[model samples]
Target: MDLVNHLEGRLLFAVPKKGRLNATALNLLEGADIQFRRENRLDIALVKNLPIALVFLPAADIPTFVGEGQCDLGITGFDQVAEHDARRRAIARDQAESGKSTPVEGAPAKGCEQVLDLDFGACKLQVQVPVKGKYRTPADLIGKNIGTSFVSLAAEYFAKLEAEADAANGEAPGAKPLRTKIIELSGSVEAACALGVADGIVDLVESGETMKAAGLEAIDTVISTKAILIKSKNPSNKTLVDLIASRIQGVISAQQYVLCQYNVERKNLDAVCKVTPGRRAATINALEEEGWVAVSSMVEKKRIATVMDELSKLGAEDILVVGILNTPKPDELSEELLNANTMSSPQPSPPTQRRSSSPPQQQEKESSLSRLVIAPLTFISFLLSLFLVDTYTTSSRRRDRGPRSRGSWLSALLWRQKPGSPY
Candidate 1:
């Protein structure tokens, strides 16, 4: 069977073949229930349940494949995406200047769009120099050699700095333009400074431990990055792409939140609702015993302890925090499942709504009557206060009888004075 023909109808999902992101990306796919099996030494794995083929590629290369429309979706670092985008723009600029095709052959003009942040593989791309070296700041390393695997990103960073420096100098005579040389290295970028190959290096810093071991200290951070999902601007099968994105999002949400259930008295339900308001609304069901209700909500795992304490303070009992293995978004649930849930579970009334003894029409009438009575009384009170202030001001004026004794504005409005009478 021809490889291209076999993969023709399937969505191409690119992922990290090795390194820090590989295992985590695989785990995410598993969490999303995307089962797959790859043959030994094979780079591609066909999904057992979906029309998707997972293409294992280098993290750096995944962005390029996705951006060029060779792959429909991919998982890679935001730093890699930035680097690839920078290179793509530079190439497009060169092609434009040369009056050639704006887009290179086999590469689309449109690039990949970030769909979701995976939140793993968090790190910073930073400019680092030797601890005892003369270079302390990024400015000190200007016009010097900087080694990095991200050549485009390093170049772009220096270009911006050089432009800013030039603008600051403002056409000063004999002022040379700052030009930092970027040395592209495939690996071992941290050792570039000690090896005498570069004055400084631009690399990813996770814990700063490796940089410390390398006798390096970061001076400037270029970009903070984490693993993110990206898809082509114009995907061949948008439905399949969206479905995959939804599944991944469900997995991410499951990891973030846990189900918290508790029983609370009806009187305290409102106060407890404020604590665990949940993603949209909390689920409340009437208990067997009167004046008690069972409440369930999704609480963030990081703040679960604080939430439970808050519930306890609000007189909630029988609190339980349950881990969620998987949680699909409400909209993503099938009609059958939604209908079943609707039938099995009682509809939850909003916590904020309270039972009123008076009917809505009676309540409206009472509100209107109160407003009518209060409006006139409030106006009368205001007038009385103004009269009292005016009287006090007049008495003070009569006692002082000075040229600067100007009557209060309210007194002037309340009384008209004769031309020659200081009354």
Candidate 2:
């Protein structure tokens, strides 16, 4: 089936609606000129130029929505995707009944197929504690109340840690009676430790700004995350899906690096080319100066300053770094993206015939019902919340702009005045 067939004649794209993720998601789409208009009553957004609908959702909830087939595509952090196991659960079920039954024991789950790695949303999930604490390893987190937005991921990691601990103790590993509590926090996870709510936090660290401000220090890195594009379990339209995916990939490629140009002596052309990696930079035209060759190339944004300094030191002249809007370079990104797309296009597995060592009938029935019915409901609620935010935001703006009472006006005027200024 095609994308139009799956998404009710509309190619559905899901993005985080608010906060840091929302800003980055919208910026990425805008960079590609994929503008969207939101409906007042529904959570669905209509893409003006493309045959698509955009759904604004929380970054953490995107995986479940995509896995449940509520959306054809989504952009979210790799950490949230891994923590929720939303993709893994879907892939596990898919592999369980694809005839060949590709074992999902250690492989990626079929919940969401990664399309591309968005370079933004760079963060590491680190184990953090008070700056003066003695904790130095994952072992210190054992039997400690850990606060995190990534409850499932924390649990999985801790379980592994406990198993290792048990093996060292010469005991068979199984469920233990550990007293540690896994508190699932919505936000302000770092503050939990300062406020004495938890002993430590498992949270995303960008530049360690928030952690430093809160007097916390990272002790161990659990995982590093970047933004990724994910596709639905049973994509309705392949053409639309591939087209959208390609466009997104192009946008990401354009954002990561700038095109550099310069002039160099023909004798030094080989050396200049070697300095400009990605092989994207090439010789263009020659100057009036004999043996002077003009060169053009692509350099990663982070390396631009360093490349410029190096080129200048090496006698390269007029080295200009121009921002790239878009390019058709297919070899820019890793082959992992292409591999992901190819592997994820197949149909998902049906509920039954998924496991060789199946659970008892009642257990299987419950599992199927939860996976097929309740899981979708949870995802639906998340999708609806995206729309609800738009409704609330519109209503809020209207109320804020309405006429205010005399007392309210007085408060506003007083609050806007300088602290020490006379009336």
Candidate 3:
């Protein structure tokens, strides 16, 4: 309750407690310089130098918290947010038509705004069937049992198909439709067909090798997804939120690019610039060795090898590719925006003050007479409005759900990929 009441003017940033996306979330924060420390099972960590709190939770819970305004920002999969948004829109429509807010227990909260894609956890929700099965397309499973972890998304996808098919057949849209039976599963969706639990399955595919091993073949992609940063519809601290988001963006950009530095003869400067132009322009310096120029620029990490080969062939020597850490190229930023961000940038605290800190004295000072009278009075009406639902929610997770944390999951390394076959 005390924590709930103290949220004013602070940005609540949620990250995955454990999952494939968990490590990425932590890495982003660390790169953004949001210093935080968690002690002995504490779920929330207050950032040392920023007005932010890091809430560790299941990735699935992030979108809901942001939508309900419990969190200002979060990092989660795009697929999770998509299903949640669809559920919210459907419920809001129902409430509007009935003139009553339908109290939907276990329904996801709405208004989660996707701010950016961090681009790491890339995969697709796909419809897969046994290789030798009679199913030819999504419509062929009209009367067959389909299994998936993403029941909401799969059900919605087939429902839209049902409507489209009915209209194509000249049947009235209002007529009761024959739907594909969707069986929700916690994990192992790939084996659903082989084990007779389903004739087909819908699940996320990073590489598609898992489906192939399970003797399943993909017929269609339901949705493509990746890691994304999201926020509430309207944040209480938009500036802080944007600032952190941009800083994280800078880190992501740094990951995708590396600084290429090389010395080339001044005569070949044009060729080098054409090969590795930084975000804006390359920095060129006159080398002490006459007629030589030192050229430095950002190059896409993925193309570094080809870029190096090209530069060497073009007579450039001492070619070096340096990895950037936190700083991103600021060529694209406007002057005014940079000025505004500079004003709010966190300043470093004195090392002496930190090393000589007195915890007891600090606590006593905060709990002095003035604070004792004012703090309680200020939050006298704060309440933790936790609503428990009796509604039972089914899992849409694929059957091989590994240990939820990224550290543990990596040992098993959920390797999803495709090889050999075309599709």
Candidate 4:
């Protein structure tokens, strides 16, 4: 079936089917209350209660599909995003060179846009040296064999290092920069050096355990890697995309927090409020016991024990910590999403301007009067436009071939008989 025809009006969300980030990714959706089930062999699934089809794909391939417009949204790693971004930048430069169209100064080079970091699958892409080797830094690996799965990113990293190294030594402007041989390996990059396949290795390290087991130590960190959500460079349904992304953020918050409910004397209200200040202020309710109140709030799951101890010390009673299934809509963001132009730093908001001294009541009255009058005016304008269009259409139809009965005209267009075939 044709893609557009089969999934019309549904947003495509590309997801990693299996990998280090897979479990976390699936848990995120489930926490967001997006129910879905994929067949044993099928890679696509429809999310219940939303016009979204989840496409299971290799994490590495997600960026390509999203960038190419084959998928509308994606969730993948920061390393993948950076790699694809480099490719996009190259493509934009090429397009500019061809004089086809000038790429925007800070627009995403590829068609994929970085929506925001979903805050899971955290790791580091690093250059590691054998524990007993002489190589100590990226500088030592110049012109040496470096093995890894992330060939493009490692190459880009080394290219910059080589450039800086030559520039520092005052090499000629056009001199050939010292480069490293990037030996690509699908897995077991830690074993590359021992096997003599390469002198050093560049790969992702979550805890440095694997590299340590193989007697390797990371010397240089190229970049930190984490799971992130991405959207089309130009989204057709921006509102829907943001809503979905926001829900994912909410799920992250829900997992990290727990609802804490407790009872406390009214005399200790001020102190209790200071202890468990939910997202804003703790909810307080009147209890049957005189001078007593019920306090409910959200507290970080990791800090629950300490928080509970603090509350207990304050003479609080019946404290309970309830795990949250999901937050649904988060008031606080776990991480900021990077936009299309690759903004690494946030822009400061402009200072507020002073408003006029006029009373708010006066302003509200004027706004209400304007709205009341604007409605009828708008309705009249709409009616006038319709009348003019109908009149023009009727006049044109009569002038072209004279007017016919309305039923006859409709039947002739819908059920017209052709000479070549039976009706």
Most lDDT-accurate candidate: 1
TM-score of each: 0.76, 0.65, 0.71, 0.71
Give the TM-score (vs. native) of candidate 4: 0.71
- Residue by residue across 162-208, what tens digits does model 1's lDDT show? 77776787944432433899999999899999999999999999999
> Which digits, one per residue and each the tens of the lDDT, describe model 4 over residues 1-423?
233455777889999999898998998888677788876777888877888889999998899999888788999998988877766665665577778875369764446878778878999998999999998887999999999888778877888888888889997555353378988798888899999999999889998899899999989899998999998876657788988888887777666877777778889999988988887667776664557777778788899999999999999977766666556554652211111112223432212222222355776788898799987899999998887676656644654585434434534454445587533
Q: After superposition, how far is residue 184 of candidate 3 from its true place, in Å?
A: 3.1
Error of 4 at 407 (Å): 89
Q: After superposition, which runs of candidate 2 have C-alpha atoms over 4 Å from their true positions?
A: 1-7, 39-42, 86-110, 132-136, 174-179, 194-196, 277-281, 285-292, 305-319, 332-423
Clashes of each: 0, 9, 12, 1
Winning model by TM-score: 1
**Which regions in candidate 4 have their CA more than 4 angstroms from the true location?**
1-5, 90-109, 172-178, 332-423
Model 2 residue pairs with clashes = 2-236, 2-237, 3-236, 3-237, 87-111, 91-110, 91-111, 94-349, 281-297
Q: How well does model 4 score by local distance difference test?
A: 0.77
lDDT by residue for model 3 over 59-136, one digit each (tens)?
878899999988999999999898787677666766887799757797554478988899889999899988998998
Residue lDDT tens for model 2, 141-163 = 88889999888777767767888
